[model samples]
Target chain A: MIEFDEVSYGYGGGPLLADVSLRLAAGSFHFLTGPSGAGKTTLLKLCYGELIASQGRVGLFGEDARSLGRDDIAMVRRRIGVVHQDCQFLDHLTVAENIGLPLTVSGRTATEEDLGELIHWVGLDGQRQSRPPELSGGERQRAALARAVVMSPDVILADEPTGNVDWDMSLRLLKLLVELNRMGKTVMIATHDLNLIRTAKQQVQARVLRIASHRVQLAGADL
Target chain B: MSRALAILQFLAGDAQADRVVPPTGFTARLTVFVSATMAFLTVFALALSLATGRLAENWSDALAQSATIRVSAPDGQVEDQVIAVMDVLATTPGVADARALTDDEQRALLEPWFGPDLPLDTLPVPRLIEVIETPEGFDAAGLRARLAGEAPGAVLDDHTRWREPLVRAADRLRTLGLVSILLIAATTGAMITLAANAALAANEQVIRVLRLVGARDAYIARAFVRRYTLRALAGALVGTLFGALAIWLMPEAEATGNFLTGLGFRGVEWLWPFTIPPLAALVAFMATRRAAFATLKERR
Candidate 1:
C-alpha cells in the first residue's frame, strides 16, 4: 500500500526522477526494469520511504513520507522489508543470525527449531552457523531474503535481489519472492534481468514498470 | 516469524555484528589512555577537596573553643597580673580550663626563632596564659573588661580574626578542587564524543548494512554505548586504583606545625575515590549515545 503521486527526486544538480505518479495496491507483485543508472533503485527507495522525493511527495502506508520523523520512518521500514542488490548484512554475524536480524532488532526471540526450519527452507541449513563473509553469493541473496521476510512485513522492496546469483540460484530467489507475494505480501523488485522477470510471470501475476526520462510507465515488454 | 527467530535477530544488532569493521586499535588505546589519565587527575582533585574539607573543619574546631590571655608588665608584676587574669577566667562560666604556661613551656614556644636558651628575666617578654572553653564558649567581653580593670596591660585573644581567614583559605581550596573535577568530567565527555564520532564515521558501511536489515537507530547506538561505556569504566577503574595508591604512598606527614600535613584521605574516607569509575562510565554513555543518535538521524 505505497503510493507516489507526481513524485520526483533529484540530486542537487538536477532531477533524476521527474513527475512520476504510481500506486502499488495491496498483495500485488511488480518488477522495475531499466538499464544501468536509470534511477530504478532510486524509485524503489522512494516507495519504501528510504529517500524522500526532493520535489514531490511519496506516501508510505498513507502518510506523506517527507513529513514523517526518523522514528516514524523506522516504523514504516519495519512494515516494509528491503533486500539490497549487495545483499547487505552484518558481516560479523552468522548466516542464521543475519537472516533473523529483523526479528532481533525488534526485540523478538526465535526458537532453534524455527530458525532451523527457516534456514532449511532457504537451502542454507548447512551454512546457518557461517558468517555472511563466509557465505557464497547465492547464500547471501537467500539470507537477505530471509531477513526481509522475517519481519512478516506487508511489503517487500528488493533492489536487484538476484543480481549476484547464478542462473539457478536466481530462479530460487525469485521463487522465494513470488511465494511471499502469493502469501499476500506486496513485492516490488528492481532488476535488469528480463528472463528472470519472465520466469516470475509463469508462477505469479506480476506487472513490469519501466523507468525512462525520469518517469514511471507500464512496460510494453511481457513474459 | 517465530518468537525465537525474532530474538536471535535482535541480538545480532550488537557491536560484535559490526566487528568486520575494525576499530582503530591505536585510537582505542588513545581513548582509554586519555580517559584513564583524566580519571586519575579527577581522583586527585576529589582527594584534595575532601582533604581540604577535613583540614578546614579541624582548623575551625581547634580555634573555635580556645583563646589566649597575654600579661605584659614589670617582672614582679607578672605574677600579680597572672593571678588577676586567673581570677577573671574563674568568673567566666563557659571557660573549661585555664593554665599558666610554665617558664620552660613558654620558652619552647619561642624556641623555633629564639633558640633554646633565652634570658627571659632580662627581656620584657609578655607572659602567656592558655585558656580553653566549652562548646558554648566563654563571654569574651566579660573577661576582657575584667582583665582591663585589673591587669591593665593584659589582652584577651579569642583567635577568631586569624582563624576566619585560615578557614576561608581552606574553603577556597575545597572550591577549587570541586571545580577541577567538573572540568575533568567535561574533558572526558569531549574526548569520548570525538572518539565515538570517529568510530561512527569509520563504520558508515556497517551502519548501512544494519539499516538495510531493519536495525533501528536505538539498536545501533546500544552497541556503541555498551562498548564505550565499558571502556571508560574499566579505564577509570584502573586509573582510580593507581591514583589512590599514589596518594596513599606519599611519605608520612612531618609536624611542621603546618595545616597541609593532612592533605590526603584518612581511614574509611578512602572509599570516596572509587565512585569516579561509575561516574566516568555514565558520562561516556551519555556522550556517545548523543553522538550516535545524532549521527543516525543525519544518516536518515
Candidate 2:
C-alpha cells in the first residue's frame, strides 16, 4: 500500500525522476524495468521512506512519508521487505544469522524450526553456518531474500534481485518470489532484465512499469 | 529513575541483537586504554582532593581553640612578666592550661631555620608562652586588655592571621583537585566519542545492513553503547585496582606527619576508588550512544 503522487526527486544538478505518480495496491506483483541510471532504485527508496520526494508527496501505508519520524520509518520498514541489488549482508555474520536479522532487530524471536524451514526453502541449508563472504552470488541473493521475508512483511520491494546470478538461478529466485506472491504478499521488483520479466509472466500476473524520460509508464505487451 | 531502569534493560541485551554488529578490535582496545588511563588519573585526583580536605579540617580545628602570648620585655623583667601572664591565664575563665615555653622548647621550634648550634641565651628572642583553650575558647580581647594592664609587654597572638591563609590554601587545593577530576571525566568522554565515531565509520556497511532490516537507531546505538561501556568498566576496574595499590604502598603518614606524606585515602575513604569503574562505564555509555545516534542520522 505505497502511493507516490506526482513525486519528483533530484540531486542538486537536475531532476532524476520527474512527475512520477504510481500506486502499489495490496496483493499485487510488479516489475519495474528501465535502463541504467533511470531512477529504478530511487523509486524503490522513495517507496520505503529512505528518500523523501522533493516536489510531491510520497505516502506509505496511508501516511505521508515526509512526516514520519526516524523511529516511525523503522516501524514502517518492518512492514516492507527490501532485497538490494548487491545483496548487502554483514560479512561477519553467518548466513542463518543474516537471514534472522530482520526478526532480531524487530525484537521478535523466530523459533528454530521456522528459521530452519526458511533456510531450507532458500536451498541454503548446507551453508547455514557459513559467513556472507564465503557464499556464492546466488546464495547471497537467496540469503538476502530470506532475510527480507523473515519478518513476514506486507510488501516486498526488490531491486535487481537476480542481476548477479545466472539464468537458472534467476528463475529459481523468481519462483520463490512467485510463491511469496501466491501467498498474498505484495511484491515489486526493479530490474532491466527482459528475459526474466517474460519468464515471470508465465508463472504469475505481474504488471510491468518502465522508467523512461524521467517518468514511469505502463509497459505494453511487447515487453 | 525510569531512565536508569531503561538503561539497565538495554544493558541486559539479547544475544541476537549484540551479534548483529561485528566485533571491532582496534576501537575496542583504544577505548579500553583511554578509559583505563583516565580512571587511573581520576583516582589520584580523588585522593588528592580527599587528603587536602582532611588537611584543611585538621589545621582549622588545631588552630581554632588555641592562642599564644609573647613576652617581649627587658631581660630582668622577662621572668616577672611571664609569671604575671601565667597568673592572669590561671584566672581566665575559658583557659584550659597555659605554660611558658622553656628555652629548650623554643630552640626545638626554631631548630629547622636557626640550626641546632644557635645559642638561645645570647639571642634577643621574645619569651613565648603556649596557651591551650577549653572547648569554649577564652575571649582574646578581654585577655589582651588584662595583659596590657598587668603586663604591657605581653602580646596576645591568637594565630588567626597565620591559620586563615593555610586553611584557605588547603581548601583551594581541594577545589582544584575536584576540578581536575571533572576535566578528566570530560576528556574521557570525548576520547570515547571519537573512538565510537571511528568504529561506526568503519562499520558503515554493518549499519546499512542493520537499518535495511528495520533496526531503529536506538537499537543500533545500544549495541555499540553496551560494548564500549563494558570495555570501559573492565579497564577502569583494573586501573583503579593498580592505583589503589600504589596509594596503599606509599610510605605511612605516621612516620612524618607531613602534608605530602598524608596525600592518600584514610579509614573509610579507601572505598572511594571503587566508584571510578562504574563512573567510567557511565561516561562511555553516554559518549558511545551519542556518537552512534549521530552517525546513524548523518548516514541517513
Candidate 3:
C-alpha cells in the first residue's frame, strides 16, 4: 500500500501539488482524473518513490519513501508496476523481450511457454518478434501493460493507459485492468478520460479522485 | 578478497545479463582502441623500469666488489712503484689479485677519447693496476693507508665517486619508469571514465527502462562494467602482443654494449607483459562502474 501524508511537491517553483493526503489500500481500484500538467503523473511518481514529496512524506509499503536508498527504492519498485502514457520501452527489444524485461531485470527466468501465454493474452502473439517502434499505439499500450504485470506485482500504477488508443481499444485495456483487480491486485490509473471511467464503472466499482486547484478531491457523481 | 571474487563472478556473467543493455558499437570500439594504445605504452614503461633496475643492480654489484690502484711515479720509477703496490695488495686479506696493466692495455682504456695510436710511453699517464677482490672485499681506507706508507706515489681508487653516480642515475631512471606507468594507468582510467559517461548519457532511455522494471544500480552498472572490462582485456592483449614482439625484435643485447638498447624482457621476465591486459581490464571495470553508479544516482 502507498500513502501520501499531507504531501506537497514542486520543481524549484511554486507548489504544483499541495496538501495531497491519499491512501491506496490493498485490493482497491482508483482512478485519478486531472487536466494536462495537473500533477497526476507527479503524484504517481511519488507513490513509487521516483519523486519524494517536498513537504510531507510519501510512504511505500509501510516505509517512508524519503528515507529509502537506491536499493530500497528498487525493492519497492519490484512490488509496484508502472505503465507510462508513452508506453516507454527499449525500442531495440522485441515485443516478447520487452514484456519479459521486468522478470529478466529481477534475475528471474521466464519460460518460453509463460512468455508465449502472456503475449497471446495481450493479443500480440503474431507481433512477438516485432520491435516497439513497429507496433501500433494500442499494441504499444498493451505491451506496456503486459510488461508491467510480468513480475506479478502487488500494485499497478498506470498513467493514461488509453490516451493514444481508440474507444474500443481503451475498453479492452480497461477490462484487462479490471481483470487484474478482480484477481486481488491494487490498481490506480491516472487519466482524464470520462468515457473510459464510465465504461470501467459498468464492470468494476472504482473510486474517482480529481486533481484541481493544486489539491486532490473525491469527485462528485458528475464525473 | 570478496570484492575480487565478486568482480570475477560479474565478468563470468550469464547470457540473460548480457542482453540487458544494448551494445553501442562506437563506445565499444573507443574503449578497445584507448585501452590497446595505453597498454602498449604501459608495456614499454614496464620494460624500461625493469631494465633500469637490472642495470643499477649490475653496476652496484660489479663496482662494489673491486678497487683499482694507480701509481704516478717518475717515468723511470713507475715500474718499481707498481711492483711495490702489487706486493702490498698481495699481503691484503680481501684482495683476490692485483696486476699492473701493460702499455697496450692502458692505451686500450683511453682508446675512445685519445684514439688507438696514442704514444702511451711518452705521456706521464700513471701506471694502472687492476684489482680483483674476494666476496667480502678489501677495506679501501685500510689499503689507502697502507699504500700511502709503502708506495707514497700510489693512489687507491675504490671507484666510489664515479660508481655511486652511475648507480644513482640508473636508480632514478627506474623510478621515472615506474612513475610513467602510474601516469599511464591514471590516464587510462580518466579516458575510460569519460567514455563510460558518454555511453551512459546516450543510453539514458535504456537505463530508464531497465530501472523502471526494478533493476538495481549495481545490476545496471554490471552490464556496462562487464562490457568495458572485456573490451579492455581484448584490446590490451593485442597491444601487449605487439609490444612484446617489438621488444623481441630489437637488436640483440650482446650486439651493442649500450645499456638502453637492451631494454626488453629476458628469460622469465617475458611473462610481465601478459599481466597488462588484466590490469587494463581492472582499470576499465572500476572506471565504468563509478560512472554508471554516479549517473544512475543523478537519474534517480
Candidate 4:
C-alpha cells in the first residue's frame, strides 16, 4: 500500500505536481489519466520511491519514502511491479530471460516449468527464444506483463500499458490486468485512452483519478 | 577477516549476476589493455627493486669484510715498510690477520687496468698489505694513528670512504625502484576507475532496467566489479608471462659484468614477479567497486 499526503514535487524550476494527497489501499484498482507532460510518470515514480516529494510526505508500505535508502527502496520495489509505456527490456536477452529477470536478480532461481507456465499464460510461450527487438508491440506488452507478475508482487503500476497496441490487443492486455486484479492484487494504470478506461469500467470497479493544472482530482462519473 | 572473506565471495560471483550488465565492447578492451600495460611495467619495477636489493646487500657484505693498506716508501724501504705495517695490523685488537702482498699479488691487482704482462716490479708501485678484519673490527682512526707512529710510510685504508657512499647509493636506488612499483599500482587504479565510469555511463538503460526489477545496488555493482576484475586478472597474467620471458632473455650478469644492466631475477627471486597479476586484479576490483557505487548513488 502507498499513501501520499499533501505531496508537492518540483524539479528545481517550479512545482510540477502540487499538494496531491492519495492513498492506495490493499487490493484496490485505480486509473491515473492525464495529458502528456503532466506529472503522471513523476507521481508513479513517487509511489515507488524513485523520486521524493519536494513538500509534504510520500509513504511506501506505510514507511516514509524519504527515510529509505536505495537498498530499502529496491526492497520495496520488489513488491511493486511496474510496466512502462515503452516496455523496457534488455534487448540482448531472450524473452524467457527477460521475464525471469526479477527472480534472477533477487538470487532466486526460476524453474523452467514455472517460467514456461508464465510465458504460456502471457501468450509468449512460442517466442521464448526470441529477443525483445523481434517482438511486436502487443507481444512486447504481454511479455512486460509476464515479467511484472513473475514475482507475484503486491501492487501493479502500469503507465500506458496499451499505448501502442490495437483495440483487440488493448482489450487482451486489459483482460490480463483484470484477471490479476481478480486475484486480489492492487492495480494502478495510467493512460490517456478513455475508451480503454470505459471498457475496463464494465469488467471491474476501477476508480479514476485525473491530473490537471498541477493537482490530482477524483473524476466524476461522467462517462 | 570476515570483511576479507566477504570481498572474496563478491569476487567469486555467480554467472546469472554477471549477465545483467551487457558486455561492453570498447570498455572491456580498454580495461584489458590498460591492465596489461600497467602490469607489464609493474613486473619490471618489481624486478628492479629486487635486483637492487640484492646488489646493495652484496656490495655491503663484500666491502665490509676486508680492507687494504698501501705503503708508499722508496724502492729500497718499501718492503721493510710493508712488513712493519703487517706487524702493526697483527697487534690491533679487531684485526684478525694481515699479510704483506707479494709481487705477483700486486701484479694481479693491476691486471685489469694494466696489461697482464706489465712489469709491476720495474715501476715504483707502492707496496700493499691486505688486512682481514674480525667481526668486531678495529677502529680505522685508532689503526691509522698506530700505523703513523709505527711506520711513517704506511697509510691504513679501510675503504670506508668509498664503500659507504656506494652502499648508500644502492639503498636509494632500491627505494626508488619500490616507489616506482607503488606508482604503477596507483596508476592502474586510476585507469580502471575511469574505464568503469565509462562503462557505467554507457549502461544507463541496463542499470535502469535492473533497478526497476528490484536488483539492489550491490547486485548490479557485482556484475561490473566481477567483469573488470577477471579481465584485469587475465590481462595481467599474460603481461607477467611476457615480462618474465623478457627478463629471462636478458644478458646474464656474469656475461655482461655490469650490475646496472642485470635487472632480471635470480634463482628464487623469479617467484616475486608472479604476484603482479593478483595485485592488479585487486586494484581493478577496488576501483570498479568505488566507481559503481558512486554512480549508483548519483543515479539515485
Candidate 5:
C-alpha cells in the first residue's frame, strides 16, 4: 500500500505535483490519466519511493518513504513491480533472462518450467532466446511485464505499457493485467490513452484518477 | 568474524548475479593490464626487499664478530709491533683468534687494484692482522688501550665505522623496496577505481534496470566487484609467474658477493611472490566496491 498525504514535488522551477493526497489500498486497481507532462510518471515514481516528495509525506507499506534507507526502499520495491514506457531491459540479456531478472536479483531462483510458463503467458516463448535489441516493440513490452511480475509482487505500477504496441497487442497486455488483478494483485497504470482506460473499466473495478493543473483528482463517470 | 564470512560468501559469488552486468571489454582489459603491470613490479620489489634484508643481516652478523689491526711502523720495527699486537689480542678475554696476514695474503687482498705483479717488498705496505672474536666480543676500548701501551704503531680497527654505514644502507634499501610495494598496491587501487567508475558509467542502464527490479546496491556492486577482482587475480597470477621466472633465470651469485647477482629469492622466499596475486585481487575488490557503491548512491 502507498499513501501520499499532501505531497508536493518540484524540480526548482515550480511545483510539478502539488498538495496531492491519495491512498492506494491493497488489491485495488487504479488508472492514472493525465495530459503529457502532467506528472503521471512522477506520481508513480513517488509511490515506488524512487523520488522523495519535496514537501509533506509519502508512505510505502506504512513506513515513511522519506525516512526509509536505500536498502529498505529496495526491499519495498520487491513488493512492487514497475513496467516503464520504454520497457527498460538489460539490452545484452535474452528475453528469458530479462524476464527472470526480478527473481534473480531478489536472491531467488525461478525454475525453467516456471520461467517458461511465464514467457509463454507473455507470448514471448518464440523470442525467449532473443536479446532485447532483437525484439519487436510489443515483445519488449511483454518481456518487461513478465519481468515485473515474475516475483508475483503485491502491486504493479505500469507506465504507458501499450505506448509502443498495436491495438491488438495493447488488448493482450490489458488482458494479462486484468488476469493479474483477478488473482488479487493491485495494479495501477498511468497513461493518456482513454480507450485503454475505458476498456479496463469494463473488465475490472478500476478507479480513474486524472492529474491536471499539478493536482490529482478523481474523474467522474463521464468516461 | 561474521563480516569476514560475509566477504567470503560474496567472493564465492553467484553465477546468476555475475550475468547481470554485461562484460565490458575495455575496462576489463584495463583492470587486468594495470594489475598485471603493478604485480610484476611488486614481485621485483618483494625480491629486492628480501635480498637487501638478507644482505644487511649478513653484513651485521659477519662484521660484529670480527675486526682487523694494522701495524704501520719503521720497516725494522714492524715485526715487533705485530708481535706485540698479537700478544695483546691473545690476552683479551673474548678474542677467539688473532693471526697476522702473510705478505702473500696482503698482496692477494690488493690484487684487484694494484695488480698481481706489484712488488710488495718495494712498496712499504703496512702489515695486517685479522682478529676473530667470540660470541661475547672483546671490548674494543680496552683492547685499544692495551695495544697502545704495548705497540704504539698498532691501530685497532674494530670495523664499527665501516660496517654500520653499510648495514644502514642495506636496511634502508630494504625499507625502500617495501615502500615501493605499498605504493604499487596503492597505484593499482587507484587505477582499478578509475576503471570501475568508467564501467559503472557505461553500465548506467544496467544499474537502472537492476534497481528497478529490486536489486540492492550491494547486489549490484558485487557483480562488478567480483568481475574486477577475478580479472585482477588472473592477471597478477600471470605477471607474478613471469616475474619469478625472470628472477630464477638470472645468473647465480658468485663468490665475489656482488649485490646484483644476489638480487633474487632463495628457498622459501619464492613463496613471497605468490602472495601478490591475492593482494592484487583484494585491492581490486576494495576499489571496485567503493566505486560501485559511490556511483549507485549518486544515481539514487
Candidate 6:
C-alpha cells in the first residue's frame, strides 16, 4: 500500500501540484486521467521514490519515502513496477534479454521454461531473438510490460502504456493489466483516454482520479 | 589495486555480460596507440637516469682513493728524489703504495692529449709517481711536510678538488630518472581516467535502459569496469612489449662507444619495466569503476 499526506511538489521555483493527498491500498485498480500538463506524470513520479515531496509525506508499504536511502529506494522499486510511456530499452540487447532484465538485476535465475512462458504470455515469442529497436510499437510496449512484471511486483504503475498502439492493441494491453489486477496486484494507470477507462469499468471495479486545479480529485460519474 | 581485482573477476567470467552498449572500434584503437607512444618515451627517460648514476659512482671511487705526484727535480737528480719520495710515503701510516711511473707509461698517458711522437725523455717535465691510499686515508698536510724536508721538489695531489662534483652530478641524474618514472605513472592515470569518463558518457543510453530493468549500481559498474580493464590490459601489454624492445635495442655497456655505454637496464633489473602493463590496467579499472558508479547514482 502507498499513501500520500498533504503532498505538495514544486520544482523549487514554481509549484506543479499543491496540497494533494491520495492513498492506494492493496489489490485496487485506478486510472489517473487529466488534461495535458496537469501534473499526471508528476503525481506518478511522486508515487514512486523518483521525486521527493516538497510539502508532505509519501509512504511505501509503511515507511516514509524520504527516509529511504538509495539502496532502500531500489529495494522498494523492485516491489513496485513502473512502465514508462517511451518504453526505454537497451538497443544492443535482444528482446529476450530486455524482457528478463528485471530478474537479472535482482540476481534471480530465470530458467528456460520460465522465460519461454513469459515470452509466450507477452506474445513476443517470434520476436524474442530480435533487438529492442527492431520491434514494432505494440511489441515494444508488451516487452516493457513484460520487463516491469518480471520481478512479480506487488504494485504495477503504467504511464500511457497504450499511447503508441492501435485500438485493438490498446484493448489487448488493457486485458493484460486487468489479468494482473485479478491476481491481487495493485494497479495504477495514468492516461488521457476516457473511452479506455469507460471500457475498463465494465471489466473491474476501478476508481478514477482526475487531476485538475493543480490537485488530484476523485472523479464522480462523469469519468 | 581495484583494477587487478576487476581483471580477475572479468577473466573468471563472473560479470553480468550484458550487451547494452555496442563497442566502438575507434576508441579502442586510440587507446592502444596512445599508450604505446607514452611508454616508448618513458623507457628512454628511465635509461638516461640509470646510466648517469653508475658513471658518477665509478668516477668518484677511482679518483678519491689515489693521487699522482710529479717530481720536477734537476734531470740527473730525478732518481734520488724518486727514492726519497718513496721512503717518505712508506713511513706514512695510510700510504698504501707509492711507485714511480715508468717512462713508457708516462708517454702513453700523454698520448691522447699530445701526439704519441712527443719526446717525454727530452722534455724537462717532472717524473711522475702514483700514490694509493688505504681506508683511513693519508693526511695531505703531514705528508707534504715530510716530502718538503726529504725531497723539496715533491708535491702531492689527493684528487679531492674534482671528486665531489662527479658524485653530485650522478646523484642528480638518478633523481631525474626517478622523477620521470613518476611522471609517466601520473600521465597514465590521468589519460585512463579521461578515457573512462568518455566511455561512460558514450554509454548513457545503455545505462538508462539497464537501470529501467532493475540493474543495481554494482551490476552496471561491473559491466563498464570489465570492458575498460580489458582494454587497458591489451593496450598496456602492447606498449610494454614495444618499450622493452626499444630499451633492448640500445647500445649495451660493453659496446664500442663509452659515451653510449650503460644506457639500459642493469642485470636482474629488467623486471621493473614489466610492472607497467599491470599498472596501466589498474588505473583503467579504478577510473572506469568510479565513473560507472558516479553516473549510475546521478541517474538515480
Clashing pairs in 4: none
Docking class of 3: high
Model 6, B41-114: lDDT tens per residue?
66666677777877777777788789887798988898899999998888998889889998889889889999
Stretches of candidate 3 exceeding 4 Å from the true structure? B1-8, B113-125
TM-score of chain A of 3: 0.98
Interface RMSD of each: 2.8, 0.8, 0.9, 0.7, 0.7, 1.9
Per-candidate DockQ versus the true complex? 0.40, 0.86, 0.80, 0.84, 0.85, 0.59
**lDDT per model vs. reference:** 0.84, 0.92, 0.91, 0.90, 0.92, 0.82
Q: Looking at model 4 chain B, report the run of 10 residues with the lowest lDDT sum.
A: B253-262
Candidate 5 chain B lowest-lDDT run of ten:
B253-262
Instruction: Return the interface RMSD of model 2.
Output: 0.8
Model 5 per-residue lDDT tens digits across residues B66-173: 999999998899999998998888889999999999888999999999999979888878899999999999999998888899999999898999999999999999
- By TM-score, the better pick of 5 and 6 is 5
- Per-prediction backbone clash count: 14, 0, 0, 0, 0, 0
Which model, 3 or 4, shows the larger TM-score?
Answer: 4
The candidate maximizing DockQ is 2
lDDT per residue for candidate 6 within A114-161, as digits (tens), equals 689878988998999999888889999999898888888999999998
Q: Which candidate number would show the highest TM-score if scored against the true structure?
A: 4
Ranking by lDDT: 5, 2, 3, 4, 1, 6
Instruction: List ranges where model 6 is wrong by over 4 Å.
Output: B1-7, B70-81, B124-128, B140-155
Q: Choose 2 or 3, whichever is better by TM-score.
A: 3
Q: Each prediction's TM-score against the native?
A: 0.87, 0.95, 0.96, 0.97, 0.96, 0.91
DockQ ranking from best candidate downward: 2, 5, 4, 3, 6, 1
| Residue B98 local lDDT, model 2 | 93
- Tens digits of per-residue lDDT for model 2 on B37-97? 8888988999999989999999999998888999998878988999999999999999998
Per-residue CA lDDT of model 5 for A1-223, tens digit only, reads 8899999999888999999999998889999998999999999999888899999999899999999888898999999999999988998888898999988998888679869999989898799999899988888889999998999899999999999999999999999999999999999999989999999899999999999999999998876
The reply for model 5, stretches above 4 Å from the true place, is B1-12, B255-257
Q: How close is candidate 1 to the true structure, as a TM-score?
A: 0.87
Model 5, chain B only, scores a TM-score of 0.94
lDDT of 1 by residue, B173-258 (tens): 99999999999999999999999899889888878866765667887888777778778888999999999999988766684346
